[model samples]
Target: MTKDTPPPPANTEQMNSPSFKLAVQDRDFLLSEPMRGVRFMLEYSKAQILLQRAKIRSTIVVFGSARFREGGPNKEPFWYEEARRFGRIASQLGGALCAEGGNHYHVIATGGGPGAMEAACRGAREVGAPAIGFNITLPHEQQPNPYTTPELTFNFHYFAMRKMHLAMRTKALVVFPGGFGTMDELFEILTLRQTGKVQSLPIVLFDEGYWREIVNFDALVKHGVIDSADLALFRFADRAETAWEALIEQGLDVSVGENDEDLARDM
Candidate 1:
């Protein structure tokens, strides 16, 4: 319209700029409702690729309360120490710490928050084995503990996807004292085993006193809610050594070389 104005620059068009790119740079489009399925695939694919690359064939998932910090509550200290001990034991004897090259079986995995989760990751660290943390985004912004392997730590926005990753490669599940989240994961795996959705794996509930007092499995059988034989799906352990032995008895393959003392260092 103005005679004095020069022509627009050749590369100045908005569509040609990097900011207008839709595939990778458009965060708003990625978060849109229609993109929910894409988000789910992204969460699944990212974890799957990394795990395969790391040769993590199997995982030992640990579930517990995020509130159970060391020296914080009545049973917190014991639970924290025992969980840590079990981590070390499992990692060392379950072929995670083996020098020979092969699939890393029974590697420690956790919810990637504080408390017993931290203890489990810490246990894997003590044995110089990698641990995985499937951390979920929360209102309070839960973070992965320091002991989780830096390359293996994962963040998830969807609980369903996070739970899927937890169960997909799990060879065993060790439940310590926890509240709602722990119980949810425990029963979920048990249901999977019950329904034959997942092959049977060792499920151990640490601290027999706490679990027995909290959940009356016998009552469930007595009420005809669950069959009496269903109780055989899991076992109880009062200590770290006992928990490891129970896992072995339940068909966990332990390496022959490592001793209890060698695995229980810095305790």
Candidate 2:
């Protein structure tokens, strides 16, 4: 070897060494098939810890179409406004901001996307209550809306885990007119309730007309698929105030404040 070409440094021989790697820093290893269970546990524990630390006692899950926009197509504007109003009503009256030693209940929670989800989060923001957004990573990347509380927002990789978190702490559910994703969420909760897996809670569908047109709950009863008593599982409302009343009738424990005159007004 030429003297000008100095011998390679001995330390440079293992520059790509795996032995020096930090296990936590290895993204490839973490994403490998063997780590799937670990990933699931991480998803559950991370959100559990954050929510517990935030003192979120109970949640009102708002499930709806991400396609609806304010001032958009037929009934979209109405749906948007009603959903927003519901969020505010729930936050204001459901002990969310009551400060009972950080025991916040019935705080709004959403899918962390636009349309109805944004409206619900926006409503919670109107009352200055902390709202949660359980966002999922998608191929096109559904962005979380600005209304979600920054500290409470979470991103999830698995749909099952995300749904689990949504259902776990939910004290009630308000479902607006939506498509496939909305149906899936609605049914998930309904199934949980029907099977005695989840305790009964308020399930309010925002638009009665739209829901009747799309889903034939009556037909299910006629066909003997679901018992007539199952119809008692959900109720319908067209306005935000009416929805709030329905929730109260369904056994939601809401403390009425002296200055809570707005709850009496229909939106």
Candidate 3:
């Protein structure tokens, strides 16, 4: 009835009490940590979801130089036929595996660039099998091959994430002649295998003649640059069929839990 009570505190429900203000401030601080944690978890969850949804019953990470060009409509690079050959073989193998039903070869994938990458994807398409192209963003180099299967093509911004996706359920790897990028992917897998981060997967280096001569790896072995055991790190092949067979023979259709022991050794 009087102004002495200050109009019943002007409906304090809309205002924060001193203790409530302190509690709110404390919550703001506390929420920051878990908010970051939640973000981390969400990113990880997204990666996991991508991995899970990939139709990777059997996979081969095909690596090759992006410089080579198929004889467009008429003019072609020197390596065009060879690259196409490799692609055809990989496709055939993938198709055969798919024909067997369960756990059969599901997809053939490439770095999703032109040249050799395109060849592999094209090969898979030719054989009527699903193929995936893992394209990356680069400055003025590489584009997703046209042959990539409509259902499986994916582009990635993070190379590490892309690499992880490449190896997620991959059964094998086939590496053709390439520059630094090819070796980068190759060594990445080797490092993963050496440290037991990933189960053993067959790695095929295309072209024995070119590989042996062009690479100084043999010199390293001869000069005691590396241990003999390291020589067993990879196999060499000159033909697409050979690489395909190596992949099939290895039978990496199952996943093994991370081997802490192997990781420890690498460390």
Candidate 4:
């Protein structure tokens, strides 16, 4: 290389990149003091709204398999109509309650991928209710569907953080037939509630037939593997109305909004 020519920059192989190291140190400094990197603007196309203190009345998170198609076993496709129905029902249930109440409205939120996520967002849009799609960039065949409300949609890099956000605002959970990802989300929430790490929230597994056949909760109870009382952790519903009724029976108001005070208390 000529004297004026520069050598290629050294590649740092350490797990924490130089930028990440600096970011962490900066964050630690801010935590101890304050106002350190306050001026550092994030390059994210959409900024995350940290509504930690915002009162959220009720949010329903719907989970299902992304690979399900539009028809059933008898047909050629599966999961398509099922996801659509799940979304449609959740939207109606949330919207009806919100309309009856006020701005403290119900919201339908999804994982922000296709399949059931799109169905949930589409259902909310169909009813003119606000919905949230929590998008995450994954290396696999996942992408945020176009049906999510632009203003309410959110993207995150951290699964734990995304899961935390889901738990933070969730009032209820509806689990549809899904794969490992769905189970991960579902069990995480269940463990949170079961361990009292988070507040008790309603969890409903839709499609009683499939759920019962796939996993036998009753057997768990019968075998004394788990306490029968623990079975009360979640409810099973065959349809949307049943799921809505289950939430209501728990003395939950779907249209409640969060106030500054409520948010502060939770935070």
Worst 10 residues of 2 by lDDT: 258-267
RMSD to truth, every model: 6.0, 6.0, 8.4, 7.5
Q: In model 4, which runs have C-alpha deviations exceeding 4 angstroms?
A: 1-57, 71-104, 255-260
Cα displacement (angstroms), candidate 1, residue 159, comes to 0.6
Q: What is the lDDT of residue 28 in candidate 1?
A: 74
Q: Against the hidden reference, what TM-scores do the models get?
A: 0.89, 0.90, 0.68, 0.71
> Whole-model Cα lDDT per candidate?
0.87, 0.88, 0.66, 0.66
RMSD of 3: 8.4
Per-residue lDDT of model 1, residues 127-240, tens digit only:
899999999999989988999999999999999999999998777889999999999999999999888887668899999999999999999999999999899999999999
Q: After superposition, how far is residue 266 of candidate 4 from its true place, in Å?
A: 2.4
lDDT at 183 for candidate 1? 95
Q: Which stretches of candidate 3 lie over 4 Å from their true place?
A: 1-54, 72-79, 94-106, 223-225, 248-267
Cα deviation at 264, candidate 4, in Å, is: 5.0
lDDT of each residue in 212-258, candidate 3, tens digit only: 77788868778996666776768887666676676656663323224
Q: Compared with the true structure, what per-residue lDDT tens digits does model 2 show for residues 166-229? A: 9887878999999999999999999988988876678999899999999999999999999999
Find the 10 residues in a row with the least total lDDT in model 1.
258-267
Instruction: Give the alpha carbon lDDT tens digit for every residue of 1-267 in model 4.
Output: 999998756654564454456754666654443542342222132333433222234467888877664544532143455455656666666542344335433467788887777776777777666667787768764677787777667777667667766777666788887778898998899888878886668888877877787778889889987788878888888766676777777655544343436644553
The local distance difference test score of model 1 is 0.87
Residue 174 deviation, candidate 4, in Å?
Answer: 0.8
